[model samples]
Target chain A: MKTIFFTGKGGVGKSTLSAAAAWQLAESGKRVLAISFDPAHNLGDIFGRTLGHKVTRFSANLDLRETDLDEAAAEYIRRNTSILTEVYSYTKAFNLDRYFKVLRHSPGVEEYAALTALEDLLRTSDDYDVVVIDTPPTGLTLRILALPRISITWVDRLRRIRRDILDKRHTVHSITGTFSEEGQKLAYEEKDDRVMQKLTELFDRYVAVARHLESDANRVAVVFNPDYLSLRESQRILDGLSDLNLGVNVAFNNKYTQGLSEIADSMERELFDGRDAPPPVHRIPWEPYRREKSYEISYDLTQLFAL
Target chain B: MSEHQPNFLIRLWRSLRAFLRGIDQAQRERVVALTAYEARELENMFVLMLLGSFAGMPSPPSFLAVELLPHLEHEIRVLNRRAESSTDALAEIMGTIDADA
Candidate 1:
C-alpha cells in the first residue's frame, strides 16, 4: 500500500511520471513523496525546486527528495567506518580512505549508492502514504534493480571462502582445534559474518522494496510514449520486473490527444487494449493534458482519479 | 642496498598472513581460499582494508584520500559530460490510488 516505481530509459519522462503520481496522491489527501534517486539531479530542475537529501515538502502533502548518490554513498560508508579500523590493519598497506575515494568512482559506484538511497527511504522514512521512485535510465536502473541478487551472490561466495579458511586452519591445527584457531577463527568469523550480514540484509531489503512496489494494495504505473516500440520495450521491462516477482498494477502517463500529437501512434490504441497474445497487460489509456511541471497535474489528477 | 628481494614465497606468505589478520573471523576461511583469487577480489580486499583503516576518524584515515577524491571528482566531471547523450526533457510522475483507496 505504500510504494510505487517509475523507471524506463532516460528521457522517457520518468521524472514527470513520478511528479504527477506524487501530485495525484497528495491531491487525494494522502501523504506522498516523490524520490529521484538517479545520480543526475534533473528532478529538482523538473520540479522547479531544489531539494536536500532528506524530505523537503514541495506542497501541502507532497514531499520531494533528489538524493545526491555520491553523498548518500559517503553516508553509507560512514555507517560502517567504525568496524574498518578495528579488524584490519588497513592503514599499513595503503591509505584506506584514499582507496575508498577511488573505489567510489569505479564503474558501478553510483548505482550502489542509488540503491542504498532506496534502502534508506524504505527502511527509515514513514513520512509518506505513497512513495514514487524516479530511477535512472534502463541500463543503470537494471544495475540498481539487479543489485540485490548480485550482492546476495557475492555473499554466498564470501561464505564459501569463510568455510574454506576454517577448514584449512583446522587442518593446520589438528591437535588443538579448540585451543589453536579457536581464538583467531572466532575473531575472523565475527568480522566475516558482519560483511555477509551486511550483504544478505540488503538482499532481504530489496525484496521488501520490490514487494511494496508490486503490491495491489498500493498503485504502480508504467509511463511510456504511445509508440509500438516504446510499448514493446516497456513490456520487456515489465517482464523483467515480473521475473523479479514485482507487479505492475496500472500503466499510465504519456497522455495524448486525437489526430497526430507528437508521440501518439495507431499501435497505442491496440496496446491500450492489451489484448495481444500475451494477454493481461494492464492498460490505462492516455488522458488529455500533458504538462511540463508536476504541480500542473492536479487538474488532470481529478479526471484521472475518476477513471 | 641489496638488489635481491626476500624470497617470493616468504613475501607472499607474509602478505597472506597480514591480509588474513585484517579480515574478520568468519571471513578468514574465505579470505584464505580467495587468496587464490587475489587477482579477482584484490580491489574488494583493498576496499575492505580502507574501510577498516578509516574506522572511526573525523576525516579519512589517510591524507591520500583528499588527493584521490579530487582526482575522482575530475574524472566524474569528465565522465558525466560524455555520459549525457541528449538533453532529455525532465517530466513529473505521480498517481491516484487504486479504487481500493
Candidate 2:
C-alpha cells in the first residue's frame, strides 16, 4: 500500500490534487481513500461531494474523510490528565484555565490531533491501497511532521526523569503508616508512568507512520500550484521533507494559468512531465473542467480526471 | 518531567507559563508558522518518523472512534441544521459549495 501525503502551504490546491488522484486510482481498480487532515476541510468542494469524518463513498472504490483534531486532543487529554492532576491543581492555583482556553489556539495542539488521526488512518484503514492526505497550511503541517520526533524525545526524557527520581531514595522501608517515604515513591512512580505511557504511544505511532513514508514504494507526493512564492515554499519544504528521510514524489499541478504559459511549459518540461529532461516529476496536470471552482456532478470522474 | 525536550506535558507546562506571563499580546500569539521562516520543525517531524522509534504502543489508537467520527457528526449536524432553516432548499444546495468551507 502507498500513502500519498499532499502537504504544503494552504490554498495551493493540495485537496484538489489528492481528490483527483484518488478518483483516478479508484477508477483503475485500486481502492483509494482521499483523506483531508486540514482544519479547514475543502475536499468536498473539489470532489463535488461532502467529505465527512467517516469515509464517505465518492466513487466505486474511492472514499473521502476529513480528520478532526479538537476531539483527538480531548481524548488524549482525558487519559493523560490524571498524570497532571497535581499540576492541574497547581495550574488552577495560578489561574491557568485562562491559558488553557488560549492554548486551544496553539498550532501544536491541533497538529497533535491531526497526527493522531493520521496514525490511526494509516494503520487501521486497510481497505484501501492508497491513502491520499490533503494537509493543512505549511506552518502547522510542518509542526505535525516534526511532532513524531519531538514526541519521541519527550517520552524518552520522561522515562529517564522517572527513573532518576526513583533512584534517589534514601530508605526503602518506612516506619510511618501514611507518611512513609516509600509510599511517596510509589505514588510518584505510578504518576511518572502515566505521563510516560501516553508519550510512548505518541512516539511509537509517529515513528512507524513516518518510516512507512520513507520508502520509495510508498510514493509520498508533495503537491503544489505554479505560483513563484508557493513553488519556492514547496522547494524549501521538499528539502525539509527530504531531511525527514521520508521518500518523496513531486507533482506540480499546473492547474491555473492566466499569463504564465511559458513558465508552465518550462515546468512541464523540466519539473512535472520532464518530456525533454529529468524524470523525478510525476506531473498531474490541471484539467480544463477544474478551471472553475464550482463543479457539476459528473457521472464518471475517471474520464474527468484523465491527465 | 525533566528540564529537557518538550512533550505534551512540557508543552502544557510551557502553555501554563505563557498564561502566567500575562494575558497580553505575547500570550495571545501561540503558533508562529515556521513554514515561512524555516523548515526546522517539519524536518524534525520526519526525522522522528524515519527512526521507527517509540516506547508506548496502545492496542489501537483512541482517535478513530472518538475524535474523527464525533467531529464529523458535529459538522454534519451543524450543516443540516443550517440547511433546515432555509426555505429555498434548492438555493441552499446550489450556494452551499461557496458558503461552507
Candidate 3:
C-alpha cells in the first residue's frame, strides 16, 4: 500500500490537503484510509463528521480516523502496566501503580504513542490501497518520523548488552547450576529469556517502521502558505526530513492569491532553489467565496493534486 | 577369622584423593562466585540501559521498557540492594574483598 504524509507548521492546511488527497484516491476506486495525527484534529470537521480513535466510514472507499494522542499514551501505558503487574506481583509492595501514574505524564510518551499508533495502522491496513496521514505540527511530526531510526539503534545496543549478559549467565550456570537455591529457573539462552525475545521483536518492529518511512512506497509533502513565517517553517521541515535521509515528494503552496503573487514566487524560489533536485510546487489559489465550504475546496484540491 | 585391614598404600591413595577433591571443590566454588558476580554486574548494566532515564541518560521509551519489567524482578532487587549499599564505601570495599576471597 502507498502511504502519503502531509506535514507543516500549524494552520498550513495540511488536514484539508490530506483529506482531499484521500477523497480523490477513494473516488478513483482505490480503498483509502485518512488519519489525523494532530491533537487538534480537523479531518473530521472537513469531512463534516465526528471522528475518533476508531476508523469511521466516510464514503464508499474512504475511512477516517482522528487519533487522541493522550488516550493513545494512556492505552500504551495501561496495556504494559497490566503485563508488568501480572508477572512481577512482588513489585506490588513497591507501589508500582503510583510510579506508572507518574509515567503517564512523562516526556516523549505522546511521541512514542504516535509512532506506535502509526506502526499499528500500517501493519493492519493491508485492506487499503492508500493511507494518507495528516501529521501534527513540525516539531511533533519530525519526532514521530525520526523515532524508528533512534529506536532501532537503541534496540541494537540493548540486544548486544543482553547477549553479553546471557553469556555471563551461561558461564555461571556451567560453574554452578541453572536453578537458584529456591528452585527458581535461570535463563542462560536467548530463546529462553523473555527480555531477549522482547528486545528482538522490538528491534524487528523498529527496523520495519524505519524501512517503511524510507521506502519508495511512501511520499512526504510539506504544506505552507505564501508568507515568511510559513516559508521558514516549511524550510525547517524539509531540512529535518533531509537529515533523516527522506526526501519531500511534493510541496503545496496553499492559499495563493493575486496580492501575494510576487511574494509567493520569491518564497517558492527561496524554498527549493538551492536543493539538488527540488520537488514540483503546486499552488492552490485562495477562494474567498468558497472558504466556508471545505467540500468545494477539497473538490478543487482533488483536481489540483491529480496533476 | 581376624578382621582384615586396608593396606598402607590403599590408605595413602584414599587420603590423597580426598585432599585433591577438597581443592577441586574450593576451586569450583571460587569460579562459581566469580562468574555469578560477573553475571550480576552485566545484569545491572542491562537494567541501567533500560531505565537510563532515571539516571538522566538517554533511554528507551518507558512503554517499551515496561514490557520487559516482568523479567527484571531479579535485576531490580539486585539494583535495589546495590543502591542501598552504594552509600557505604566501606561496605562496598568489604564486599569486593569478600567476593574475591
Q: Could you report the Cα RMSD, in angstroms, for every candidate shown?
A: 18.8, 22.9, 3.1
Highest lDDT against the true fold, candidate:
3
Query: Which candidate leads in DockQ?
Result: 3
Select the stronger candidate by DockQ from 1 and 3.
Answer: 3
lDDT at A209 for candidate 3? 90
What stretches of model 1 exceed 4 Å from their correct place? A40-42, A74-97, A160-207, A210-219, A227-236, A253-255, A261-265, A269-294, A298-307, B1-101
Q: What's the distance in Å from true for residue A12, model 2? A: 3.9
* Predicted chain A of candidate 3: TM-score: 0.92
Question: Candidate 1 chain B: worst 10 consecutive residues by lDDT?
Answer: B89-98
For all candidates, the clash counts are 29, 2, 0
lDDT by residue for model 3 (B39-72), tens: 7767877898798888998788766676678778
Residue A186, candidate 3: how far off, in angstroms? Answer: 2.0
Better of 1 and 2 by DockQ: 1
Model 3: docking quality category: medium
Against the true two-chain complex, what DockQ does each candidate achieve? 0.02, 0.01, 0.62
Candidate 3 wrongly placed segments (more than 4 Å): A87-96, A179-183, A289-307, B1-8, B87-101
Tens-place lDDT digits, model 2, residues B1-101:
55555577788998898888765533222211111111222222222222222323331222221222221222233334444654775554434333433
lDDT of 2 by residue, A216-279 (tens): 4365556666666667777666666656655355554535555666665665443334222222
Q: What lDDT does candidate 1 reach at residue A223?
A: 65
